[model samples]
Target: MAETVTPAVGDTPAPASTRRERTGWYVYDWANSAFQTTVITVFLGPFLTTVAELAAGCELGADSCAGYVYPLGIKVAAGSYYPYLISLSVFLTVFVLPVIGAVADRTTHKKRLLGAAAFTGAGATIAMAFVTGDRYLLGGALFLVANISFGAAIVVYNSFLPQLGGPDERDGISSRGWALGYLGGGLLLALNLAAITMLSEDDNPQRTLDLARWSIVSAGVWWAAFTLVPLRWLREHPTAAALAGGGGNVLTDGFRQLGRTLREIKAYPLTLFFLLAFLVYNDGIQTVITLASQYGTKELRLEQGNLIITILLVQFLAFGGALSLGALARRIGAWKTVLLSLVLWTAVIVAAFRLPAEAPLPFMALGAAIGLVLGGSQALSRSLFSQLIPTGKEGEYYGFYEISDKGTSWLGPLAFGLVFQLTNSYRVGLVSLLIFFVVGFLLLLAVPIRRAVVAAGNTPPRVL
Candidate 1:
């Protein structure tokens, strides 16, 4: 059932006096990011590969035995299909998030929707424990559900930003949320890693497998536990009376509203341009996050412990970097800060391609550089987009924002996978990402920010 919120009558807005409540709301990121760090980005890929090989009836250390297997049904080169699976997941999210976002906007059930999505995601993540052997299908299925829920929940969460703050407070609030998320995510990831180390052996195959499963489960539990903060702290705004005119058919009306939004894009050119730029650059960023672990393990051949440590470093670094970039963005414009991030990303990708296999230190250095730029780029991008959205239509526009964020993500991974398949080289695949960075940077440079913000129905402030 949908939960209802009653907005306070007055000039100040619902979130104005609720500083402690807003802080609690921001903590949800910290609660949820553990899944991204430990399960999705770092540990899960390698762990799944190991599980697949075992399920294929292969013994450890046997020369002829399979060491890795694809979760997809493809028997010929399973590793190549992993990227495609990622693309497929993103494809599903692209179709689903906008509608969900629209529904939240028109309905009075934003918190209910968010809670449902969080539980769904967290449940799927926790269910990863039972996935073993040929159960790679089970793992993938759970991952698909969790990933979709996570993305959808984010839509609801982001929609709250406009409701929570006036224009003057939005960037700081958004940046603080990101920073807290990094800290929470990093802290939980550390605990999970410690549990794995204490409970399992480096060479004991069975125990190590158990440890991996535990790590995934911990992320789920952490996510569920931390989400309570936001669930309690954030309040949904009242649904408009106009949206209630359809009686019991409000959901249908919500869909109609979304269709209307799509038709109205011609009225907002800057929003259109920003969406395009966001789609392209965000794809590049996603590719980097998804592929870096595989690149470390398969291509660089770094030790597992070192790889884990590097990822941990990234979480902490990203926390610091996000705060730093927020400050930097205040000094130089947000657009320039974003441009700087793109330049750094291009250099990092190019450097990754050029790195020698024997020198793992360079790879670690590259990871740190990525950590510095990654959070800043994404956090600032979200804030920039927030500045462009209409006052009351944040949810509807952010629905489209999800489309831009996740829709063509397939392009980056598909490009990387295809390049790797054709050339049989990770270097070539790494180099290909440079194209996304360059193209996105060029396109972004051409966007007239002030005009775009105004066109999206935001009042044009003098400096921005």
Candidate 2:
């Protein structure tokens, strides 16, 4: 199992070689990440909770808020709105992205599908501007739609990876995309933060909420505008003509192909092992990104402005961090660097439990640490996984990859929400994420990377 996977050398039709095509693909990352940073990481979670608290008529910061009933007869603490909404979103996407992936593989409208997903998501994000007081249900609905779209778009976006570069070129190229994402996300967040500061009145929660709504609109605009780059330029291999021959039923053929791919995956035990490990650790990562602001605000009593600044700091740091870690991967091997990053993740969670409430600087320091590893770890994992994908089945295989990515996203938030509900302590919930990293770390160790590569008909990178 420890032996590296090294398939015999075989020629693959090289991906598009033009610089414009490559740059167009990278720009899509720059586009969608605005939603990831401004909406998911920085603003929407805390803002929605505030809205839910108002909707439920719960007195601010009261234990009785736990008794407040949401739209679906769902009783959750005022603090529970964002995490619960995200949990629901991730649960749905677990099923959706794989199907989207399968279809993208069978169709030639990959760019069109990508555009539809992005615009639909942007529309949802823009609608968040209408989510005012007592509009928790509306906000939740939009979040669900936007999140599902986000997950679906990412499926198609990631599937393009194997078409963009060969196995040897994937690590650097993937890192560049993530770094671009950080830069784009960070830039929008900075402007949004500044806008929120200028427009939001310190004493007026409602006014602050209004400004936050506009910020959401701005992020959507940024996402839609930048998305046009990839939509116009990133070409897909011709598959549309073959669609007529496949029983003229894209859905049935997609399902059939997906079934075959699922069965095929059983023969690649190491790939399965890696997916399981990724499912666990990436959940921890996603949960932290999703909930960190909420925990900082609701539990630690940090100011929104300080938290926004911290998020901005993370975005900038992560840009460099992705590049740095990619270079580090070249030196130490991606597996070892990824494991090291997981250790740091575990440490961050541990540090989170002990972080003193109302200490913005300390929280920001912890955020900086998270920033340093977050992009690096995720980027490397994507590239490493790319090396193990069976040729010509990139879309279907990456579909399973995304399923692994988003499927487990449900567990972390649900656990965080449930733990917070039971004990009314965010610290306890934060500590619970440690199990993911630890378990993932152990599972990662058991993976025979070299064997996985060879079994999937890939050559293991020399560094690995």
Candidate 3:
């Protein structure tokens, strides 16, 4: 397993899109990341949680104020409401993105779908400005629309990878996309923090809440405005199926195509196994990210200032880290680079489990390390997946890929919660994440990547 999977390298190169078009692709990442960083990461959950708590008739910081809020007449702990919304959004995307992907592959309308989904999400996100006191239902419904549209847009976005660059170029391009995304997200977040700080005065509680609401609006505007860059640059390259002229209704045919692909997919075991490994490990990665602030605050009692700085550090460092890892992948193959990253991921978990209270410096160092590996592993995974998708089926496969790629899968957090409940130790629960990396590593190690490329009717890249 230690030996690299290097196949014969005499095949003709894959046709890559022009450099300008590739830049357009990168800008889309830059655009959407505003939503990820601003709404999803910084403001929405906390704001909405506070709202839910109000609905439950409890002050947020009150001791012994464990209470429930009902959304759509269903009982939910106020604290758990955000997680439920996230789980619901992710679950819906499992059905939505795949069908969207299947449709994109069969039509000449990929670019339209991308713009439509992006704008639809941005519109819904903009409407989040209206989600104030006792509007938890409005917030939840808007998020479901925003998040599912986000994933649908991403499926179409990811399918462009194979066409945007040759296998040799994908690692670099994907890295740049993630790097730019981090930069974009970080910049907007900094401005947002500044606006929130300047406008929020002591004793003006209403003003403070208003600032948060407006920041949500700014993120939506940013997302919608930046999306034009990609839509302007990307010309649709119709799929073979598109040119073949089936004349069938796209929605109906898309699902039919989806059903067919499911039945036919088993023959590509290498790709299936890779996806399984991805689902497991990526879930761990996302769960760790989602829970870190809670762990730092509840377990370590770190100040809010410390957490903010640590998060911003990861954002900037991940930009450079993604590019560096892509360069490394060029030299030592993407597959092995990812395996190395998993080892680093495991080390981060070990350090986290042993972290002591009130140690901001150590915690910041951990953030730096997580930053170094986060974008690299994720960007490479997307590029590597491009190699294993059967030609003419890129959209559908990447749809499946999106389910595992983003903020969707919630099972890892579910497991993490269960472990914490059983042991009553955050450290023990954190360490339990090791199982995902370990299983993913073993599964990835067993994959014959070069053989998988050939099996997918692809010419193996020079490195892998």
Candidate 4:
């Protein structure tokens, strides 16, 4: 939510003064996305894999390591370390994210906490520059810290959505933030790629390694530096509910709040039901975003070079896509627009299942289609969800939102893998995901959105 909606309890009624702070909120998206695209989505895996392969005694640039390494008496594939570390981070984050969200609700310093999380994550990314000479463990350790902090930041950041504006404004605000994120992350990745290309002309192994490390460092710097905008301008948008005293240390209070939250959330069936719908569909969305490259490479026999280009295409186009979707939401309501996007998503999956091999142009067209609906769905999902949350529970509820989306997200991939294992058909594996879209869409329709919004004490948008 680029800013706010439904005018959080302490705010004036849709005042003009809030615009600057809202702009600052959008800048936060711009700042942090560098870390997301550069490190998480693109660079870190291959770099860490290279370093780990070296640690396992593989020659630089060799096709395979021909060995396994033991970490804590567990045998692991050298190429798997990066993904393993990411999974570990997400697993651990499943616990930490709720705590962060609960604390955000309890505290007046939500903005400060957002800052702290961003800086800590950025610091870890900066430290990644020293991950050299078979020190893949060090790199993994740093990323673990960074990834957890990133989740914390998102929870706190999302908590601000309700505090920023009114119902009619939220869809656009959230969509714009997402758009800036795409543009920012895309720009940074492009610049980093250009720098690496110029500096690594010879393709020397050590030079490439150093370039990769510095590129990560640059991403961290980008995150921290741009964060100053929000830190400087985003004022505390306090809730009307008084901050209740628990008479415990901050962490203890946070957990205490979380316990109460779990019990009380049952009162809001709308929130709970919306959350269920979000979890089901968002899982499918995340799976496609995660596995698209693998499907292109292994299933369609697309070139590695072409796959990279496709990723770039998705990143840049998603910016415009997000804005376009926001506009659509204003006209048709975010809920209905999202339902329409799901229809498109189902079509995209069916089309993907039938895409021909060695066809770069068709693959690019598919990517363009994915990019168009991707940002709109996510932005509006968050916008629509913000309405169902009760007053004073932004952090804790969004924590549930974040955790459900991130935690069980693996189910889609698991099902896809099982289908492929049984049928020996990548097309079947890919199309199997249609179940997630269909089921999630039906669940979403079952939500009774306006009734839920009214129950949650939120103003329904004009279109809705």
Candidate 5:
């Protein structure tokens, strides 16, 4: 396996031509976020749960199916299946993302890997139209493939950030990407929501199913169509002749390098500390993203229309929030800004726990608060870690970063699920998230950013 390397951070001037090329790279986020918004976050979760119940041959209202009682002894419906499917998807991504990221870096074919993943995801999304009663397994399978591709493509996309921006420019560029993503995602989701409302009737199950399928296909088509912008604009880095001299395979090298990096972490204490902080806090972030809708539906008893509207508000607010945060970071520094966001997150989670079931306004207020911090925290964290990576191993180190982002995500969700399962209350689950925020905030405070960047630059190279 090839070892992960960071690009040099000196004031090496990027060519004017290269700067021109970077514009198109931002468009990829615009293109791909449609899938994230429509398929993963808003539309699909509810649709899948609805479909799963239909597949299980359970009536709209039933006490049990397949001998399993509903946790709350409420009606056993298709909605019950969605959480399990999402859990399975999360589990698969944890194991697959690191390997996929490593392979893309070692091969110096990040673009190709990204393209392949995108196409696979798109195909699976399109195939969702075939899902029907007794086809829950098929729907689950497609979701698995689509989500894995989404995660893998993200690794490749993030790797391009270093090529586009230096330490001075990275925060702005990262913020721009995230903001653009929110705009693109929100626009498409709004269109899909409109289509569903206009084309489907309340009592027409087949028509509703068709509308759902079209929404899924729209995400795939949107992703594939928009990807061309980045495909045409970005350039891959030149591989070193000496490093390429042997019959060394990039895939084999990637794994070897990953192992070596794991062992070398003790020498980079600050980097280690940042990674731990990221792991903990990001777990909370991922849990919120995954479970927010479920919480609205199950605990708050929100109507579908209200839930969709709240999500749409989140998308637009996230755009403004991310850009404003970039400006704020410039004034006070990224680390402090992130700590403040974590504090806000803790407060919001506590508020969510206290929100009454009938209070839709407070729930929307909660969504607005989430929008303000979500984009800034994630975008700045990516840029911050980009500064810490050693030159030449961007892919390898990011592989580990992806592991932190995706791998440890299970902790938050698992804890949330367990708490909900035991207490039959999401309030307990929401309160437990405070622990992750507090721990991650303390760990992040311990990292010395200046020393870590210098040490990462000075570290000696090694063959994986």
Candidate 6:
């Protein structure tokens, strides 16, 4: 509810005020990724499935657990627990996050809002430790809160991009943040993997489950602790006084601004086209990240320790990949670099279908392939989009960007779940992602970055 200080037009600085503040902004990426890497990408899916099975009074080895009634008396199959929950959370968030983003744009203490959302999400994550056997409802409710907060916080975080740098610096800056994110997430994942391996007893599922629960709790702690740096250092830029025609009510002004912005967005056709392309491919990428460990656990019958290690490998390798792709973008351009990454993503999906169940070597190779492209594709996409946003509207525009990112996310997971339910095959479910990648690649090829920049009344990148 904080209002921004108004500054005269054309008075904003070229970049962040100091190296310290810039580092603080980057550290936020390091802070929040613990939840993304550990909870969303690796552990939570398998853990929630176990909880669902227990709730249904079924043993771990069963093909299907019947009579697992979710909250509100809805019956859910055990196999669909994680995917359906993710889909449900995304569906709910897509409706409200844009409004949250608009409000953040009007606030002077944007960093405070970001910190509040981060800690609130982290609290939900820490509470996951209490979700014991037959407590699936508790786990699902907590996950919904965490995911919603995560999405809202990201809207505020991304709005800081224009303040950090101009178009030329965006790729390196964005990629550096992503690399730091990998470092932070990877470091904690390694520690948790070591602890879980040491604590897990042979032939004891309960002990392994307990260790996994503690790992989730630790990620929450890491998120809250590291976020303090950004909260203390990142200064808020002045906002327009007549934001949405200068109404007294901030929320009313925010919605009015959002509507005007949506109407104006049509003038920049390439921006809309690029967003469509991003919407498609990002769906595939998000689906792969969220479902990878679940596939390893359920389809490949891999041990929990190995799946954790595989993703640990992914995190570090993705660190290098993010930096490497950023450097590559300097030579070729961010758009070209991202398009190339999409090619690799397409290959990764096709190869996924051919991977034999229980083969460590092939699985590890797939993990390596995924690690190589994962960070690069996402980092470049963000940088490229930052180049197209109009001046002084970062928060409102980023809300639309996030909507494209998370709103379409439900389609990929829903498709994966439905395919698995119908065919009883994870491979078939995975194949559905290929459609997203291929279509996205084709759409991206048509975007004119220079034209898009000019259309948005922004400077075009030198390379483009």
The TM-score of predicted model 3 comes to 0.92
How does candidate 6 fare on TM-score?
0.93
TM-score of each: 0.90, 0.94, 0.92, 0.85, 0.87, 0.93
**TM-score of candidate 1 to 2 decimals:** 0.90
Model 1 lDDT at residue 270: 76
Residue 374, candidate 6: Cα error in Å is 1.1
Q: What local lDDT score does residue 379 receive in model 5, on the 0 to 100 scale?
A: 80
Question: Residue 311 of candidate 2: its Cα lDDT?
Answer: 95
lDDT of 4: 0.78
Q: Which wins on TM-score, candidate 1 or candidate 2?
A: 2
Candidate 3 structure quality by residue, lDDT tens digits, 61-122: 44223568877788777656776777777788888888999999988888999999999999
lDDT of 1 by residue, 1-464 (tens): 32222332234343443676577668878877877777777777767655555666667423223234544445523345556666777889777887887787777767888899989999999999889655767877887888788888888888888776655455566777888887877887788777766776766767766777888899999999989888887766744633455555656876887888788768888777877888888888888787777778767777566677778888889988998888887777678889899999998888888888756788788889988998888888887888788665677777767653522266787888788777767778888888889999998888899888767656543244
What is the C-alpha lDDT profile of model 6 across 1-464, one tens digit per residue?
33222321232335535667778889998998999998888888888888888887788545445535466677777667778888898888766677767777776668888988899999999999899988998999999998888888888898887787766777888999999999999999999998987778887788878888899999999999999999987888746643434447766867877778777878878888998899888988999998888888888878887788789889999999999999999999999999999999999988878888777678888888888888888888988998788776777777767764532277788899888877877888999989999999999999988899778877777785
Candidate 4 error regions (>4 Å): 1-17, 52-69, 78-80, 202-210, 241-248, 291-308, 349-362, 404-435
lDDT of 2 by residue, 94-188 (tens): 67877787777777667888899999999999989889868888998999998889888888888888777766677878899999999999999
Q: What lDDT does candidate 6 reach at residue 4?
A: 27
The Cα error of candidate 2 at residue 448, in Å, is 0.8
Error of 4 at 160 (Å): 0.8
RMSD of 5: 5.7
**Error in Å for residue 220 of model 2:** 1.3
Q: Which residue pairs show collisions in model 6?
A: none
Deviating ranges (above 4 Å) for candidate 5: 1-17, 55-57, 61-81, 203-210, 239-247, 404-408, 458-464
What are the Cα lDDT values of the candidates? 0.75, 0.82, 0.81, 0.78, 0.72, 0.83
Clashes per candidate, residues 3 or more apart or on different chains: 1, 4, 0, 9, 16, 0
Clashing pairs in 1: 30-181
